[model samples]
Target chain A: MLKATVYVTLRESVLDPQGHAIQGALHSLGFDEVKGVRIGKYLEVNVDTTDKAQAEERVREMCEKLLANTVIEDYRFEILEG
Target chain B: MRVAVIQFPGSNADVDMYQAVEDIMGAPVDYVWHSHNDLSAYDIILLPGGFSYGDYLRCGAVARFSPVMEQVIKAAEEGKLILGVCNGFQILTEAGLLPGALLRNASLKFLCKLSELRVVNNSTAFTQDYSQDEVIQIPIAHGEGNYFCDEETLAKLQANNQIVFCYENENPNGSINGIAGIINERGNVLGMMPHPERAVHAWMTSDDGKRMFTSILKTWREKNGVTTNA
Candidate 1:
């Protein structure tokens, strides 16, 4: 079995109001070193396939079809074997 | 005209849309389940506002894959009139029936209040009753209503006159160019965050939305060659 860890983040062009709010809160908390904060989604999927190539293909398709909206979000995934 | 108000599992505004079409507009309307596969019987499709699928992943993300959305896409291709309000608008964008996506409000809060909007284009089937630049009040209720699109798409929308409504003065959600509503290139499909149906009655707040339903009826009548003196 293989596990795919996916991370989805808003594209650079799109504004992240939640992230901005978080940055503000951090500033109030005296985290002066924090220049920016962007929020995103993380998902971990366990693929039943043993073939690494097939797992990668399936995970990519999942991200494109349902997990991530490519219009405003960019996604990357890493596969782990157990 | 026959209207279908689509009802997804988490949809809360389906009855509002149904009443708007049936009681207010005096048109025949029905509620269609999300699992329904056919939409050919309905002349107008209305997607109402609500947290479809509990708004789990993203607003309208999971609901976009509902079985009925395929028919919605097909109906759009056939030039059927479609109106998506709030969550419906989000679903339309996720379904690719409309361009761009709606993000969280800039304030990061759910906004529920009347918003002033200017009619940008009155030539389309949805807004012919309103004069160009006419300002009307419609209530918006959503946490994710900020509209965003790439610059190239914005240019095309501007050039094509697909922008149907713009926020009059105060940009509530910080949408791109204060876009309140937009129509598809074919002019048959419209998506707006504001709930025109909720504003149809005087008691509810504003009656300015009455003309929008009338405009749709008028356009449909003109296309079908039905003469109505009312």
Candidate 2:
């Protein structure tokens, strides 16, 4: 089994409201040095494929088809063989 | 317009959305709790606003792991019309259905007020009822509504005209480029902070918000007709 870890994040231009909230909290807590914040998503998928390339391709398809919305998000994945 | 309004534990606006959808479109609307797994049959799937899961981790963080989200994500992938309002918008971003996270209000307060939004793009299925640059008044109530993004991504969105709605005048939560709502490239998914369902009636100030629903209904009808006729 191949495990694929996908990290999906909003494109640089899309607004990130949650990260701003956290930055506010951090600033309030005296983390004033923090300049900017952005938030995205992390997803893990277990693929049943022996070929690493095939697994990566399938994972990419999954990200494109449903795992990620490519319009506003950019996704990268790492394949782990177990 | 058969719609399914998914309800989570902390979702406070599901019923209001239900009423607006049912009353405005006179369509059968279902209140699908967060635990229900099946959402394949619904024409439209709505994730209503409210403090889901007590805003744990983030506004919509805990709710992102809901059982119903799996189905919602699946439906969204199938090219169904999905709308996320307020907290629902947060959930969509957290679930990777939409872009960017909703942060604290720029004023650092739980803001609740009526705001004007300019429809920047009317080409999408969700905004077909309104002309481009039409300004509509809608209510916004949330603490984490600030939007942020990197410079490059901002330029790309601008180049693609992906920004669907923006603040008319003053920035509400300091969203980058005053973003109020945005749609995916395919135009099948939308995530926005302002509550359109709250403004669908004259009593709610204006029926301007109804335009969104009308647009979706018209698109669904047209698409369905085209499919059946073919």
Candidate 3:
């Protein structure tokens, strides 16, 4: 078995409204100088494969197929031993 | 002009969008349930706006896991024209099909009103009918429509002309650079907060929205080189 962690984040050029809202809230609350903010998602998956290469392939497939969108988001995966 | 509108639970605008594309635009349109995975029959796949999955966890957070998205993503990669509007835009972002994320309104209020949007780029297959800097009126309804991105990425997008639409006159949600809509790198997928379907005809409001769908139809015809839409 293999454990994989996937990190997904919007591309640098894409806007992040959630982070902006948080910044606005901070400013409204008197926390000035909060330069910037951004948000992203993290996901972990467990694959029932022993071969590291196979598991890695599966993880990448998962990201491309569902876990991540190659268009506007970038995702990276890290594998863990069973 | 066969269009497929994917319907998810809690999607209120699915029927409206379907009618606009099918009945109003006079194209053959069908509603594909979110569970369906096959998209080979349709020329266009539209993810219409609405609060999908009740905007649980986050707007479009849960709906990103829908089964149909798998097929949509594949078809999009194959150069199919895919449009996501409003909540649809949020879902596209969450699914990673589009860039950026939709956060709460700058004022944290649910805003529903007609907005003026300027066409920033008319080079995409979806915006071929528009001219550069064309201003359009459409309705936007959502609590989260503010767009954000890093400075470097913003510059890249500007350089590449990926931004399709920017708010005019009023920046409703405080989007970065007043971005209201954007297209992907391949120019096949488009996501925007404004609802063109909501303003396709004069009776509905204005025909500015009709031009977008018409433009897509024109693009498909131009690419196929066959003008047979009977």
User: What's the number of clashes in each of the models?
Assistant: 0, 11, 6
Tens digits of per-residue lDDT for model 1 on A1-82? 9999999999999999999999999999999999999999999999898999999999999999989889899999999994
**DockQ score of each predicted structure, in the order shown:** 0.85, 0.09, 0.15
What fraction of correct interface contacts does each candidate retain? 0.69, 0.06, 0.12
Candidate 2 vs 3: which has more DockQ: 3
Candidate 1 residue-wise lDDT, B149-227, digit = tens = 9999999999999999999989999999999899999999999999999999899889888888998899899999999
Among these predictions, the greatest lDDT belongs to 1
Tell me the lDDT of model 3 at B4: 94
Instruction: For model 2 chain B, give the 10-residue run with minimal summed lDDT.
Output: B221-230
Model 3 regions more than 4 Å off: A1-82, B228-230
Q: Of the native A-B interface contacts, what share survives in model 2?
A: 0.06
**Estimated TM-score per prediction?**
0.98, 0.74, 0.76
Candidate 2 lDDT, B42-124, residue by residue in tens:
98999999999898646787788899999999999899999999999988988888766676676678889999999999999
Per-residue alpha-carbon lDDT of candidate 2 for residues A1-82, written as tens digits (9 for 90 to 100): 9888889887775655667788889999999899988777787888778899999888888777666655557889999986
lDDT scores in order: 0.94, 0.85, 0.85
Q: Quick one: best TM-score, which candidate? A: 1
DockQ-based class of model 3: incorrect
Model 1: what TM-score for its first chain? 0.97
Q: Tell the DockQ for candidate 1.
A: 0.85
